[model samples]
Target: MNRQLTNSKLLLKPASASPALHRVLTVPQLWGIAVGLVISGEYFGWNYGWAVAGTVGFAAATVLVTIFYITFIFSYTELTAAIPDAGGPFAYAYRAFGPMGGFSAGFATLVDFLLAPPAIAAALGAYAHFLNPDLSPQWVGAVAYVVFVSINLLGVRDSANFSLVVTILAVAELLVFMALVAPGFQLKNVVAHTDSFGWSGVFAALPFAIWFYLAIEGVAMVAEEVKDPRRSIPRAYLLSIGTLVVLAIGTMLLCAGAGDWRQLATIDYPLPETLAMVLGKGSVWTSLFASIGLFGLVASFHCNTLGYSRQLYVLARNGYLPAFLGQVNERFRTPHWASIVGGLIGLGALFSGTTDQIIIFSVLGALVMYIVSLLSLFALRRNEPQLERPFRTPFYPVMPAVSLVLALICLLAIVYFNLLLSLLFVGLGAISLGLFWRFGRQRINVHLTTLGEAERH
Candidate 1:
């Protein structure tokens, strides 16, 4: 009998009775999954920080958030490598602190993955609008939901292959964008608005800074499907994070220095607009960049759609969410219902609010999940020293401790700046939790009690 907290098999219904997730994903496909889930961040969303914090202030905020993500990812990969579950943060918390902890982290994680695509969808629509002035971005976003969800339903291997190709194109697009804009970059332009909001602006910009790397952790959701969960998951995470950090900072600086940073601050299609500033609005360069920019957004949209579906499927499988969503299509071996439900929800979000609003809400969910996940990492270390760790976080307590503290600070700052939206987020969590408690109390007790007896034997 294994005493280590390496899996929640005891807490879960015997997986032998369940439809298993495929394990065909390799390191490269995992990289595609990881980067595709987040590269859209490079395409749009972070510039909103510029509106609140100005160029220098936002850059400083980005630097701080980058540090937070680096430490957080190093610590988090330990859990993902050991557990290798689709529920990701949810599975980690359940192992460390039982059902309540799992629910808290899982709910936040659900929102983080679920809300992101709609925000990306809005940007997709905005990009379309930029190209053809009469195209309605919201409806264009609606159309994208149809296309990407269908791709996901095809099968994991097929979708992953598509992600790899688009991720390559997205990465290539960013590099091209930087090169094209570099000659126009001027130190004076970046410095022009340094005084607009001062230190306070940095705090306000934290969530947008977070926007730059929001869903990279989502790589964890695909852990079950990775060929070698222990070694492969960690490698994918490290590769994905390194790629994002370089691209994020480089894109932000070059775009800011290329022209008036303020102009890019409030829009969804900042890269295209930034290129227009450098290459002239009607220049072939602006048109080509705008058209190709869709690759980045499509990569993220396609990948995040996969992420949210798996989260939903796992939750349902564990009895936290409605059972119907857990059903995997026997033919495709994918969580088909979860994909459809998540897509419909994301489409509603795309049409209901502004892209920046959806982004902030998504960031709020991510901050909560980060704080809880870091806490779980600490708990697991104290409680389960025997657990297999293929990749240990470099600094141990210090690394995770720093990440936890930074997560707390970012959470507090966003709550302070957006009190109303913060309250709304809380209300949504509370209502969902209330419903879960009402319907799920008995089921959770059954799973935990069964697991407890199994462990004691």
Candidate 2:
């Protein structure tokens, strides 16, 4: 009874005492942030799927992953609208479960957001290498980390506006590339390796397939910053998913059909190189397109930097991490320390692992988050029936259930294929949870924001 009374007191404590996050984002800006966070996948990571599954096998894997994201996003948006917290899944899981649940969700999300930047940074380096063979991609990626983190430190509004412009340019570049490559689309090239790897390879390709829409959920991490999140979240999510689906399928087909799919499967700058295949190595079109291709990579890297910092800031603010990370800059009202700290972690990851390894760890983290988040949705619906869900999920239990089941399947497939790495991931989770269980459990023993407060929002 004493513990319960203490928790109740903490729950009712006013959250306004903490510094306010700038609620300046609108629907268009939200859409840009959503799309921008995942655009780099189209540029680099998805091609690796082809390495494991061949063209047709990888395509099947991508379709399954796409179905998961579409259903998951529709269902997940409800939680975002209802809770409106910067911690994303961590906050939702806490309200649904408890401190242990919140820490679990936070840890998984941290892995996803923190690890993703280095993978994208590696791609930036690869694109740089493509542009100038003399440039070291790792060094170039290192420079990117510094530049974009500085941009984020400036402020959220400035950061988001940059995302909008760069996302538009990235989307335009993609459309143009598709237009140029469409005329040369060949069924023969696409089907050339149709049965080479067979059905088993499709399972092996699941993690790589996830790259197509890996960070789309990141939009939810900034929910506290969105203006009128109740109405804006659903609109922005719908638009973002539709745009990515079309782009993913169209880009894959065009690239496979451009030439032998095998040749482009291993490189980071596949789209530009695909154009080069059609237009020749020295063609002006290939040169200019490759130069502009940096926009898409830059957009994802920049937005992801924003996403991880928010994750770090919220975790710290809620007592899951060191309190220093939660401190906001008085001048910019941004999470300056969070951005810098997350970037430093990303750089360490960049040097320690290969691009493929980094991608697998990131996707693994994503699947864990998906599972935990879906479980939270179910628990919250049952226990907190009165929670003001601005956007209720379509089909309720069925939609969330489908997302949960698919997430389990993807998680199993990835573990089966990458056993060693999966073990390492599990080991890391265990260590973090073990430490939290021993040392700091009391620090976040109360719900910082009660469901009553969330419902009012």
Q: Write the per-residue lDDT of candidate 1 for residues 1-457, one digit (tens) a residue.
A: 2433323674345322557788899999999989999999999999999999999899999999999999999999999998888889998898888778888988999899999999999999999999999999999999999999999999999999999999999999999999999999999999996764888999999999998999998988888788989999999999999999999999999999988888899999999999999999989989999999999999999999999999998888777887788888888989999999999899888879988889999999999999999899999999988888999999789999999999999999999999998999999999989988998767655665667787689
Please, what is the TM-score per model? 0.96, 0.95
Q: lDDT per model, in order? A: 0.90, 0.88
Task: Show where candidate 1 strays beyond 4 Å.
Answer: 1-7, 10-18, 446-457
lDDT of 2 by residue, 118-208 (tens): 9999999998899899999999999999999999999999999999999999999999999999998998999896666988899999988
Summed backbone clashes in each candidate are: 0, 0
What TM-score, to 2 decimals, does candidate 1 have? 0.96
| Candidate 1 backbone collisions, by pair | none
lDDT of model 2 at position 364: 92
Error of 2 at 32 (Å): 0.6
lDDT of 1 at 89: 93
Structure candidate 2, residue pairs in collision? none
